[model samples]
Target: MDGARLDQFDRKILSLLQADGRLTNNDLSERVNLSPSQCSRRRQRLEDDGFIKGYRAVLDRDRLGFPLVNVISVTLATHNRDNAQRFADLVAKLPEVQEAHALTGEMDYILKVVTPDLKSLADFVNGVLLPHEAVQHVKTAIVLQTLKETSALPL
Candidate 1:
């Protein structure tokens, strides 16, 4: 995809924004060594070019009763297009399946999931995932601790 190439100023802007998305234009400008108007214009251009897609508040999953986090690897019966799409649609409707990706090798898909506890996770597997017609097998690995979890993209 052809897009605007990032220069040093753009990289600085991204670095500052990645840390604190809610920074005021004035604050951001000061941090990035640009005038308020210039910073505002640059940020808007970044958004228009799809460099800065959107901003969101990161919430603690534990506070929402979804402390448990795990990665689920799914293997499908076949590599056909229909089966892959069916699997994707099925995973989309399941709230517990936070993110899904069609992958390579033995595992056809990988999912990032969050739930209340191990029992709840088991229930989801038995009640929902296993029942899906396209899913051949599913393997899950629980996350005991997170070493690093940041959405910042290196410029």
Candidate 2:
């Protein structure tokens, strides 16, 4: 639903769910000061209306063997729908590329990539990204420290 149509209770429900998606209906009702049935109906409505997407557990990359994070900027060989589509097709197959964004600036795209180590990162950049016909230049910066990382959106 649109922001204009969301009541205070709806906003609270969204804010609380954003903080913790696993909140049970009973728990959410208690926190939001609403009846359990009301909470359930509202939440279901939100999901039905495409407000709440499907949820998944957030994994720890470091413990899972992918510790290195890199922010890579890409300049495509050409600025055309075909080239952009080709680049999009390439990134879609790469599991290491966690996030990809088409941008408007000096660079055509920015990628958030994760790898196990320096050698693996090098192999990915050299063997995969650079060899792609659509890529003209690739610049990667290894993340030494992450101050804050979250997927939660502000209500």
The number of the candidate with the highest TM-score is: 2
TM-score of each: 0.93, 0.97
Off by over 4 Å in 2: none
Itemize residue pairs with steric clashes in candidate 2. none
Model 2 agreement with the true structure over 1-155: per-residue lDDT tens digits: 58889999999999999888899999999999999999999999999999999878899999999999999999999999999999999999999999999999899999999999999999999999999999999999999999999988787
Whole-structure CA lDDT of model 1: 0.86
Model 1, 29-103: lDDT tens digits are: 888788999999989998898888899898889998999999999888777899888888888788888788877
In order, candidate lDDTs are: 0.86, 0.95
For candidate 2, what is the lDDT?
0.95
* TM-score for candidate 1, residues paired by index: 0.93
Model 1 root-mean-square deviation = 1.6
Q: What count of clashes does model 2 give?
A: 0
